[model samples]
Target: MLYSKQKVAKAVLVLIFFTVVLIGITLVSLNNGRNGTRSLRSFVSEDTSTSPESIDEALQYFIYGAKYLLAAVKSTVSDNSANITAVSHSITVVKDRMQMLLSEFEHHLHRTEILSFLSLPVINNHNFSYIYNREDICSKKAVKLVFVVPSAPGNVEKRQTVRKGSRGDYVRKNANNTILLFFLGKPSPGSNYLSLQTKIDEEVKEFGDIIQADFEDVYSNNRLKSVSMLRWISTYCSTAKFVIRADDDVNITTVEVVSALERAAETLSNFIIGHKLIADRPSRNVKNKYYLSKKEYPPPTFPPYLLGGLLVYPVSTAKLLYQAALRVKPIWLEDVYITGICATKVYIPILSDPGVVFQHRKS
Candidate 1:
């Protein structure tokens, strides 16, 4: 179980900590001669007289040395705090690689148990004809942002709310440079699909911001929705400097996203930033909507992924992810498949940005 692994990891970390402490003390001792202090070797060698004062002096020297050693370690740790953080980040990257390898092995081992679970028929074909696409939105000028929102066809009210909100208004006013498009698939079978499609057509005609694809709008096809968005961006919005994949229910400020992008403009290559989810395991409870059977996903923990609520990356990163998505086995969990698996495949570095806010709408 994961608990045993955590216990072993903690033990290793403790061992490493003690090893560092010993090394610090050794370096401090070796530098005593250069710093005009009595070395421990000299203190022992010179003080050979069997007087009680000599013994007391030796004891006091050792006490002083202990204090000095502690101070050196503390100073070293403090001075190199940034380096320590980088080391921790490197460890996290290594952990992600290990988990990815484990997941791959498990997938191969149980390939036959699942029924076309990872197949990407929609992605491979690349025949995503837009029922209502704003292909000309970014045609005339350079686009600064392409905000992609994936929504269900039934959530018409949600779409309108987002449009009337501040974020949508920002996109609407900056239509020449910024764009917001809703990506959707065909309506579900239980709903009035034709009627809903009619309403969507009307909405798109009025607002010119919908990109309906040629697939079913079901929970299992969530990854396909992302694939479609990427494909669209690659085909039509390649000039965009940045792209965001957010959910319809999530409230995100466009101005804040633009500001974050501004701060990260210098190092935009191979970059993806979002709220990170590390060591999250799939739910096993059947009653839970996010449940996954052992046969579907054999790993104990998922690879680190960004939450599906909001994701920000450059257009170049999106292209790389789309290319990787075609080869990597698809998963129903869109966030894990795109941000975790595909991003890892292409060696795109995902930065954890705590400032990306997500306020989910109530049901």
Candidate 2:
């Protein structure tokens, strides 16, 4: 007998939940066990013959948890009036360590690379030895896929409803008609906040594929964002002609973005609309996480920055941007400094729509 599609999806959700839980327990047990803070014998009664599938599942969960934990640490580390020098230095050390772990766990799965061939990538002129996949990067015109990283199955499904079938792929009436808002990654389990994130991610699935993708690193959270982003750019850009990148917190009208982008699809190199700022402060300073040393960027105002909250770039631009980001030093704030710098260096202008973009800076 064949099961209904709903049943199948539900079963998959259950499997994932248990898998994430067991993995979390096991990793916690092992580490705590070694330190003698907690005993591991009690939790080791389960089957030891773990298969590649099980290990892979566990590792992914470990990585997801680490990402959340890292965000938690960075967000909570410094006090309100902390000195920029000391806080900045501490953050730098943590960022360096996180980048190391992220570097170590590079390829858990071929992610963003899955859909890269759409637009013709503009050549990168950075100081580092950057390799451009001329043949595959941004060669395609359009493609379809779901974004699964931001939440759980049920939540992802809801987001898909908002994103999918709403305005139909591309917003404006134009040729190159497909643009998908793909959301991916894992959400923390059994938490009210994560539950909300999962719900939002499900809604995003309607827009594309929300695969249960994760990077396999338990020690560092930066590794997950860094790793997941690398995966997304590598695999996803190949199929999309133009792409939209966003965080779950912000409000995004994909249809409006498509309409706005389509208007300038002919003249623009790349577009990133939203309130953009290039922070002049130092990121290492615990007081201000959105820090960039004045020496690195001397001007009081940002050098044509974009609000990392929402962005729309040609697939080629995404590929080029990610590649350029990899070669540069990883900063504390991932989206702004890394993406803004990469885009600015290569002259990939962050397109903006003043009407839609909103930014509130810390005074």
The TM-score leader among the candidates is 1
RMSD of model 1 against the true structure: 14.7
On lDDT, the leading prediction is 1
Q: Tens-digit lDDT track for model 2 on 1-363?
A: 122335434544554454345433434433444443543444444564753354345445545645664564455344343343335455544433443333222222222332232133534222221111222423454453222223223444344443544333443334645433333334445555566555544444433334334432222233245335445655645665555555444455655665665554443434445556645434445366455565554545545566555566565666666665655444444555545665554445554564344232222
> What is candidate 1's lDDT per residue for 43-150, written digit by digit as tens?
335553553343234334333444454455444444444444434443333333333323322322233332243344435565757777778778877788888999
Q: What's the distance in Å from true for residue 214, model 2?
A: 2.5
TM-score of 1: 0.66
Query: Which segments of candidate 1 are over 4 A away from where they belong?
Result: 1-123
